[model samples]
Target: MTMKDPKSYDLLSYIVVFLGFYEGVLPFVAKSTDWEPFLSLPRHLSSPAWWIVSGLVIVASFFSLWGIDIAKKRRHPDA
Candidate 1:
């Protein structure tokens, strides 16, 4: 079977990583500072829905990175 070019999706994978990182870290930053605009965000951060969605996005990003790595290795076995 032929494999799709992994390079084509590198940008997408990186974007997911960024988003996951942002989602996971934003709440912590919001809570630790007195940033006026983020005051309300800290409240929602305590909800179960917030944790679930953040966890899902972070997990998805991890899997996406792993898949890309496997694809690249399969495309270049000797490397």
Candidate 2:
């Protein structure tokens, strides 16, 4: 089967990575600092919904990277 655009996958991987970092960091920052809106975020992060979201982010990142790898392999099979 043919792969989709590698650049698109690469961009998506970058975005997912950024989001994963944001999700993981927000609660820590919220707890450690005095930001008003951020302070409440940490409390909600303990919920199952946040966990699921984080999991999905991780999965998306993994898949995107995998796709990129496949595309690179297809592009340079001899490497």
Candidate 3:
């Protein structure tokens, strides 16, 4: 029940990490007079705590693809 090594999963991992990093930083860089809370919420949600959760999510997402690859490999070991 191990995972398979698929290039697509790696690319997706990079994309998700990039998106999470963007979400984590955009709020801080945003400017406004009274839009404080909304902007800050994502920053908060993107905190170390949430980052840990999101990191797990990215790993799980990678595993999901890995699982698919594993199944495919089981079906066609030559591939």
Each candidate structure's TM-score, on Cα atoms with residue i matched to residue i, is: 0.58, 0.47, 0.38
Model 1 poorest ten-residue lDDT run: 34-43
- For model 3, the stretches where C-alpha displacement exceeds 4 angstroms are 1-46, 77-79
| Model 3 accuracy (lDDT, Cα) | 0.52
- Candidate numbers sorted by TM-score from highest down: 1, 2, 3
Where is model 2 poorest over a 10-residue stretch in terms of lDDT? Answer: 34-43
List model 3 lDDT by residue over 27-67, tens digit each.
44542232344533444563466555545555665666576
| Candidate with the greatest lDDT versus the true structure | 1
Model 2 scores a C-alpha lDDT of 0.58
Q: Which ten residues in a row have the lowest lDDT in candidate 3?
A: 31-40
lDDT of 2 by residue, 1-79 (tens): 3335556545666776776556645544554584535433333665676656655655666776787677767875654
Question: In candidate 2, residue 13 scores what lDDT?
Answer: 61
Q: Write the per-residue lDDT of candidate 1 for residues 9-28, one digit (tens) a residue.
A: 56656776777677655554
Stretches of candidate 1 exceeding 4 Å from the true structure: 1-10, 31-46
Clashing pairs in 2: none
Native-to-model Cα distance after best TM-score fit, residue 12 in candidate 3, in Å:
13
